[model samples]
Target: MSRVLIVDDAAFMRMMIKDILEKNGFEVVGEASNGFKAVEIYKNEKPDVVTMDITMPDMDGIEAVKAIREFDSNAKIIMCSAMGQQTMVMDAIRAGAKDFIVKPFQAERVLEAIRKAIG
Candidate 1:
């Protein structure tokens, strides 16, 4: 099973992602609510994949992606973004996110991003 780390400021968002990932055979290794925490957890857990939220307090997803990439260039990160944040999404991609999933996350899309990212 692929190990995953979910990073989102909203607890409910994290829970929702956890449920989706768990049901689809992905092992959620850790979760973080902010970019700083995300980076910390990424270093410790070293999960195979990461689902990162673009907008967050104390660091945001783009910065987190950069930080993680600095630590591990091979990191596979799938950015989660809300609608209307197209610019941010592009920035995340530039920061080394392998893929992205828009909010109001559909199960299949999330799974697809994860699969593609991990592959």
Candidate 2:
């Protein structure tokens, strides 16, 4: 199973992603409520993939992607955004995210993004 780290400010969002990932055989290595914690956990845990929320408290997903990519050029990050955040999504892509998943998430899509990212 691929190890994953979920980053979202909302506890419920994190729980939802964790549930989906665990149900589909992905191991959740860690979780963070904001980009700062996300970066720290990522460095320590080194998960195979990360699901990053767009609008976080301290640092946003785009910045986190850049930070992670700077640390590990091959980091696999998947941005998670709500509808109508296309520009931010593009920014995340530019920052080195491998893929993106829009919320409220669909289980199938989330799984697909993670699978493709890890691949």
Candidate 3:
């Protein structure tokens, strides 16, 4: 199973993603409620993939992606955005995210993105 780190400011969102990933046989290695913690946990855990929320507190997903990529250029990141955040998604892509998933969490899309990213 691929190890994954989930990053979001909302506890419920993290729980939802954890549930989805675990049910589908992915191992959830760590979770973070802010971008700062996301970066720190990422460095420590070194998960195979990351699902990052865009509008997080203290650094944001884009910045976290850049930081993680700096630490490991091959880092595979997937940005999780709400509908209508096209520009921010573009920014995230530019920052080195491998792919993106739009929320409110669709299991299939999430899995697809993760599979494609880790490939």
| Candidate number of the best lDDT | 1
lDDT of 1 by residue, 7-114 (tens): 999999999999999999999999999999999999999999999999999999999999999999999999999999999999999999999999999999999999
Please list all clashing residue pairs in model 2, or write none if there are none: none
- Candidate 2 vs. true structure, TM-score: 0.98
lDDT per residue, candidate 3, 1-119, as tens digits? Answer: 89999999999999999999999999999999988899899999999999999998878999999999999999999999999999999999999998999889999999999999999
Q: What's each prediction's clash count?
A: 0, 0, 0
Name the runs in model 3 displaced over 4 angstroms: none
TM-score of 1: 0.98
Candidate 1 residue pairs that clash: none
Listed in order, each prediction's TM-score against the native is 0.98, 0.98, 0.98
The residue-by-residue lDDT of candidate 2 on 24-76, one tens digit each, is: 89999999999999999999999999999999987989999999999999999
lDDT of each: 0.96, 0.95, 0.94
Q: What is the lDDT of candidate 2?
A: 0.95
True lDDT of residue 119, candidate 1: 86
